[model samples]
Target chain A: DQQVKQNSPSLSVQEGRISILNCDYTNSMFDYFLWYKKYPAEGPTFLISISSIKDKNEDGRFTVFLNKSAKHLSLHIVPSQPGDSAVYFCAASASRSNTGKLIFGQGTTLQVKP
Target chain B: DTAVSQTPKYLVTQMGNDKSIKCEQNLGHDTMYWYKQDSKKFLKIMFSYNNKELIINETVPNRFSPKSPDKAHLNLHINSLELGDSAVYFCASSLTIGTSGAYEQYFGPGTRLTVT
Candidate 1:
């Protein structure tokens, strides 16, 4: 079973515009949500994250909003740049599990048009 | 310097062959993990080691084995490789496994394995 799901397979946005990527999870036990950006042939790099206790977390141009009631989270990038084009993966983990195991969603490919 | 490094960035082998992928982290982290990304872009955890001890082992095949000789190194060895084994494998490291959300994983440039 896919605990986490990214309904959209791909997204396209223009540079200098806002881009949003959405993710949903079936497991309410997940306490932490994270986003990673991956370039072709490279490993995923951390982007932003939000805890279950917080509704939103912001890191510069990247912002993550979490809604525990809806079991959903989203990553928003304002004024998207061409360099922001890459695959974005949504991941979640139950921190208390101690194993640090993460359940990841099928990644969403973001294309920022220059 | 690379935080996590994997040797043999690309491996192409025939079915029924045996191959190993070596991973090392210089970040002085206490936890290391192995993840596999298949053609569908699904990143799944295969194994995790903390301080040279196995912490988590997913329901992977018996043909796949993970060895952590020390805290900084974790290696994956595959025996009798199958066609389904072709994918990109990633090695990652984190400071600790806790509920504090400080455990951000840093990943190495992945090793692409193609089995024919």
Candidate 2:
């Protein structure tokens, strides 16, 4: 069974618009959620992360929102730029004692067009 | 200054052959891991080691083995390679098992393994 799910396979956004990526997870033990961005032929790099305790965390242009009640998380990139085109991944980690493993979801490809 | 690095950015071999992918992390982290991404683009964990000690082993086949000779190096060896082994293999590292609740993981550029 997949613990984490990203329903959208791809998303298109106009440059300078907002791009929202959503993720859903089933594990109640998950305490940490993260977002990663990857360009073709490169590894996924950490973008931003939010702890389950917090509803939202924001970086320069990227923000991650987590709703514990819904077991859902969303990543928002505001004023998306052409350089922001890439695949975004959502990951969750449960309490570490048992496994503390970070599980990933199917990626969502984001295309920012000028 | 690559934090994490994997060798042979690409590999191509025939079925029944054997091959290995090498990984090293210079971040002085205590934990290292291997993840495989299939054609469907699903990323899954294969193995994880902490400071040369095997800590986590997922439900992977016995044909796949991970060896950590030292704190900085972790290599993966696969035997009797099958077409099903074709995928991009990634290496990653973290501070600990998130033992203290540290949850960041750094990854390396993947190795594209092609089994014909």
RMSD of each predicted structure: 0.9, 1.2
Kindly report the docking quality category of candidate 2: medium
lDDT of 1 by residue, A41-78 (tens): 89999898888989999999999999999999999999
Candidate 1 chain A — worst ten consecutive residues by lDDT sum?
Answer: A93-102
Question: For each prediction, how big is the interface RMSD?
Answer: 1.0, 1.5
Q: Across residues B1-116, which tens digit of lDDT does each residue of candidate 1 receive? A: 88999988999999999999999999999899999999988999999999999999999999999999999999999999999999999999998787354558989999999999
The first chain of model 2 has a TM-score of 0.96
What's the number of clashes in each of the models? Answer: 0, 0
State which candidate has the highest lDDT: 1
Q: How accurate is candidate 2 locally (lDDT)?
A: 0.92
TM-score of each: 0.98, 0.97
Where's the lowest-lDDT run of ten residues in candidate 1 chain B?
B95-104
Off by over 4 Å in 1: B99-102
TM-score of 2: 0.97
